[model samples]
Target chain A: MEKAEILGPAGNLSSLKAAVDAGADVVYLGFNDSTNARNFEGLNFTEDDLREGIEYLRGKGKKFYLAINTFPQASNFKDWENSVDKAVTLGADALILANTGVLKYASEKYPTTRLHLSVQASASNYEAINFYKKHFNIKRVILPRVLTTGEIRTISENTDVELEAFILGGLCINIEGRCYLSSYVTGASTNTEGACSPSRFVDFSPTDGGGMTISLNKITLNRLSAGEKSPYPTCCKGRYLTSDGELSYAMEEPESLNALSLIPDLIEAGVSALKIEGRQRTKSYVGTVTGILREAVDSYYVNPASFAVKKEWTEKTRETFEGTSSTLGSYAGK
Target chain B: MRDKMELTLGPILFEWERSEVLDFYKAALTLPVDTVYIGEVVCVKKRSLTIKDIETIGKDLEQAGKKVVLSTLAIVSNEEELELVRELSKLGFSIEANDASALKIAKDAGRTIFAGPHIKTYNKHDAFFLESIGVKNICLPVELPKESIKDIAQNTNLKYEVFAFGKIPLAFSWRCYTERTYGLSKSECAWHCKDHPEGIDLRADTKENGKKAAPIFTINGTSILSGKNLSLLEFTEDLRDTKVDALRISPQYKDTGEVIKIFRDKINGKINYKDSSERLQALIKKPLTNGYYNDKAGMEFLEINDILNV
Candidate 1:
């Protein structure tokens, strides 16, 4: 059986080096702009940083992918085109794109560059994946985190394009590209602006009763008691009051996706790569997650029949999570 | 002297009973809508109307002198949903492609495609690409401003439409919030979404005092909608000038016929903007918002005077 390549997230030069040193076969990073999904402040790479990181990865014989995944608006469409131009010019191993406009430009402008359909495109089915492949000569597609392991197997059987599945990190319960909860509150859009519940609009204030309230654009998302670890205030994870007058996590409880046990199933399902989501995370997090998953994959390949999830791997990944707990997400089924 | 813009009744985004859906379209046939989009665009689990039912409804609407378009599921994850898109595309009605899977299937079947708002046509380049693939009309995403719509219109000759009214669809999740709120799992949902014909109102407490809670979002099965309705009745003049081809109004549970009439009257110059705006405000239960049209938050409401001035 062919081993699935372990793909890691790299926010900057340090995270890139950390992921490479921790045995990630491929590391993906984005420009410090709205072109990528992780367009947060002080995150992602500068042009100089991209050049230096590419050189370092080339030296280490590791591959790097560039994400220009966000949908481009009419006003700044050129910026996306420029990012595509720059990424290909920098000798990126692959370019991950979400918008059809960007895909058309990249495919026509640079016909030789490898293109992976971003999860933001929300192409969850094989037909959609094949559509991208047929139109742009897309080489791979990152499946959304909404499919079951069985469904992934069925899709793999149908499409000839390579499939990449998310193995770890922040879990978006909503379909990525279709969601507009962030833009409904803040004017910024995750689709167009690549910012979801942007940190600038998020405010944390202490309550009178020694609790803290997290608000996005002055709308109270959740109120945490003192000493409670608050998850990042994305609209989907927030607790709200239903019409029944009960306050609950009506959408989803704050949680991260940990697919450690499903490594064998995903590989058998024909996933060519396993992606660890989170370009906004620190280098320490990038290193720890990449290292743990690397060990799990290696152990599974060496002796598939004897492979079992080590408790220490799960515990170590839990430490770097934003949510209090982790789940297998949609992989195991609802 | 541009031609009068048409009004399209978008597909039902909520889970209504079979009889209710049939009755809704039966009434829609008498309304002033030029085109009627019928089919399920939300959760596939809520199968109140089957493919046969949709075909019957489409036949009835077309016989009533209305162009009928069938919409596909917004998120096609499984084979069951993909088969539905294929089946609908072959049904011979015009197809509204909500996802790339549907878009490709419908186009391959030689069905004229209407790119739904979820297809992400943000720029003229995106619109041009869709047009190249044989999409006849494009319903711009709800987040775009008037300027962006005009920008796309200026660059492309394809027919353009904007979501003008109803609870704007905001997000979708794999887990059914309706079931989760009622303390049930998605697998055992038992069709609980039919209980709330509109949707469950999700409210948040006000910042001024924790005593009052304002409606923030509407939890409809797996999808989320804005708590308030979006009305562009006051901005018909602005829309007319943008050279848009049509205005889409998502069918709500109540007063849909009246809403369609009001838009028709406003578009035909029978009712002025103020009277039509007031009439719509009185009909809707929640507040009205046109913030997205002005390039602000989707939930924020811009007053009539403020919108016109801009």
Candidate 2:
């Protein structure tokens, strides 16, 4: 069996260092700007941080991937182009991008640099993935969190381009590249603006019934009883009245994507890399996930027949799972 | 003068009965709009219409003096659906591809293709790439601000279209929200989507004494759209000021001819922007929103006066 890369997310210098130490084959991070999806405060790297981080990774014999993944508006075109130029100048290994325009520009201007399609592009099937690969020379596609493990196996068989599957993190119920629920509520689009459930527009108020009602831009997203864990108020997970007029979790229950149990199957299906999806997380998260996945991958390869998933593996990672709920997501959906 | 700008009716995102669709387009064929797009672009499982029904409707709509276009699914999952895409491309009209998979197949078939908004072409480079690959016309995404549309239109030679009316398509998913909401499996559900012709509205509860629950989203099968409809009636002239070739009207479950007429009159300068917008507003049930055109939240409604000065 070929070795699969354990890719980790780096929110800052500490997380980058932690990933390297924890056995990350490659670390993907973003600069401190709206171009990155996790454009949160006190997160992401500065120019100097990126420069030194690249040096540190090079010295350690690991790779750095720049995530200039947000879609650029016409007014922000120059900024996206400049970031592509900067990534190459800094000796970054590859760029994970979403916008079709940005991909075309990078493929034309810097032909040698590797371009990985971001999950935001939502290329689920072989033909869509091949379209990106054929037109832009995209080297890899980070599959959306909406496919089954069997589906991934079929797609890998059809396409020669590399496939990067999300192993663990906050799972988006709606496909990442197409969703605009956050933009409707807060004027921040995941596709165009790179902010979904932007924290700035969220407001909390004490309900008269003794629970708290969470609202985004004044529309109550959810009302939680005291001690009820408040999951991220994504529009898809929110309870809505159905056509039969019943209010329930209309799309999905709030959960985290944890593929630790399917590591052997995913690898056997020909995934070239496993991606850990949290650039907004703390260093502890980056370190812990990288370590667990590293161990799991190594053990599975060292003795494929003897390898079994230990309960402790999921228990350790479930500490950070969303709403204390974990799922294989569309990879194992009903 | 630029030849009277075309008004095209986009594919219906709802799952309507065959009779309802045929009658709706029967009326739509005589409307002020110059083109009528006929096909099922949403769930392939919604078999309310057969290949024969589509063929008859396509022939009837063409005979009724409207240019007909067949649209492909926004997301293709299996080989059967890909085969369906090729079948649609072979039909005697231009193909409107909502997914790149369909785009590639259409290009291979040497069909005249129009790119759908789901392609997410944001700038001149992407638009030019679409043109390079045999797309004759491209509908810009619903979430794009006006400046992006203006830039792409000005910089590219490809004909462009904007969502002039109806609910904005926000996302597409394989899991059906309606089936899950009803606690029924995908195969077991008894066509509940037909009940919600305009889609089920999702509202946010409010604590304010005088406020109503704000309708935030509408789910019609696999496509999730804005609860409020998007209208560019107030800015038809402004859109025309740019290089935009046409304004696309995504059909709601209403008598669309009246809405299409309002847009045509507004574009022809027969009615003032305010009066036409007021009339158009009176026809649709949902609150009107045009925030995306002005770089605000998509569910927001801003006036021409407010966005023009910016």
Candidate 3:
């Protein structure tokens, strides 16, 4: 079997270099516009910055993928169309798209540029996966973090397109790109606006008891005890009073998903790429996770029969997340 | 075109008893709703209604000269569910694909389809693609503003539907929030969602002191819906003028029949926008919002607040 490609998030220029230098075979980045999922400030590349990043990746013999995955609103779809055109001009290896209009336009205008279905499209089964492969002729699909490894294996067996599974980082409590929770709370959405719990709508207040409360759009979402690292106020992870009036994390815990131990299993399931989910993290995190994943994949390919996750591999990445705990998530949840 | 706008009752989102489910449809038989979307669209585990049961209901509804649409799950992640969607498509009714996977099966089987909101038909290209396929109608996503809905509704020859009432479905996930809230797994969830027939309320405080406020969201199995139901009773004129074929009312746990009557009156011009909007509030006991119909935050009533940093 061919060695699985290790993909990393390229939030900015330094992060792009961090991912490439740390041995990422492919790096996915979004433009400065709010057309992609990680609509954060100072996080994505300007058009010029994207060109520079592509040049850098080409110099290192690596691949570049542009994610223009947000659904364009009806009144102003020109921006999304323009972004797809720019990505094709930059010679991106593939375009990770979610919108129907954007995907159709890209396939027709830039016939040579390959297209990869974004996880935001929420194509979880062979039928949906193959629909894109047949209609848009999608070369790859980034599976939403909702399927078990067995289900992944089954879909891979049924569909011809390459499968990319998320191996590390934050998990969307709701299925990718289908969620309206953030927009309900703060008027930002992963599907339409390419943002979830955007920082600009967040406000932190110090309580009289020395605890801090994080609110989105003047609504208290989560409260942290003193000295605790206050996480982003994503609505799904927020602690709220349940039906019986118990204050708890009613929707989901603020835990990131870690699937490192499933590397060999995923590879055997015919998944061609392993993607890390953080496109909003700093360069240190982008670099370290990319480096660790690179080592793990390389070592697995060297000795596939006796592959195992090393103790050092777990230790080196322990503090990368806030909770220091990870979940196998739907991979095992099913 | 008909003298009145078509009224569609969306899928039953809550897990009611089998008897209650049957009774809801029987009562709906008399309501002014033209189309009733039957079948499971929320979680696969909700056993209140089965494909066989929906087929039975479809037969009765069809005999009564009403339209039936079998709605598919919003997040279809496995093969067994795909098998179910495939089977449902051939049940002698139009298929409403809440998931894109559902669309594929319906298309392959040569069935007429209604592209639900989860399919994300945002532009003319999406509309054209669905038209090329067997899809005859596309339900616009709930968050679209009046201008955006008009942009497509007027431009495309395809029929369109708008979510006119009920708690707006916000998101869906693999892990059931109703089960997870009680420290139960999805498989072992024990149907805790049935206890909150309307859904467990979620409140986000307006002040920093962590004070109590009205519920802002509701947790029902894997589905998260708005705390308050969305009522577009006031927008009937504009919707009809724009040639929207249907006004979808998501099935609520209570007063669904009453809500349907209110919209029906509004559509026929028997009631003015202000009078009907006020009557809708009396039927459903929660705050109402039309912010999404206007270009503003979804939960806000009129988006009177400043666009703080957004």
Interface RMSD over true interface Cα atoms for each candidate = 0.9, 1.8, 1.4
Number of the predicted model whose lDDT against the real structure is largest? 1
- Angstrom error of the Cα, residue B277, model 2: value is 2.7
Question: Could you give candidate 2's per-residue lDDT for residues B149-249 as a string of tens digits?
Answer: 99999998888889888888888786787676667755466788888888888876553468656578888887788988889888877788787888999
Looking at model 1, the pairs that clash are none
Each prediction's RMSD over C-alphas, in Å, is 1.3, 2.1, 2.8
Any residue pairs clashing in model 3, and if so which? none
Q: Which structure is stronger by TM-score: 1 or 2?
A: 1
Predicted complex 1: DockQ:
0.83
Residue A287 lDDT in candidate 1: 98
**Alpha-carbon shift of residue A103 in model 2 (angstroms):** 1.8
Cα lDDT for residue B275, candidate 2: 86
The sequence of per-residue lDDT tens digits that candidate 2 reaches over residues A1-334 is: 5789999999999999999999999999988888888888788989999888888888899999999998887788888888888888988889999888889889989999999999888787888889999999999999887677777888889999899999988878777777888887778888766778778888888877788878788777777887777566777767665434565666677778888888877887778899998888889989998999999989989998778877888888988764558888777653
Per-candidate Cα lDDT values, in order, are 0.90, 0.83, 0.85
What DockQ, on C-alphas, does every prediction get?
A: 0.83, 0.61, 0.70
The prediction achieving the highest DockQ against the true structure is 1
Across B1-310, the per-residue lDDT of candidate 3 in tens digits comes to 5457899989989888889889999998888988889877788888777778889999999888789888889999987788789889888788999888888888777888999988888777789888877789999888887877888888889889999898999998888988887788887979887777888898764433455688889888898999988877777777787678899999998888989988888888788766776787777767887778876678878622232121
lDDT of 2: 0.83
Looking at candidate 1 chain B, the ten consecutive residues that score lowest on lDDT are: B205-214
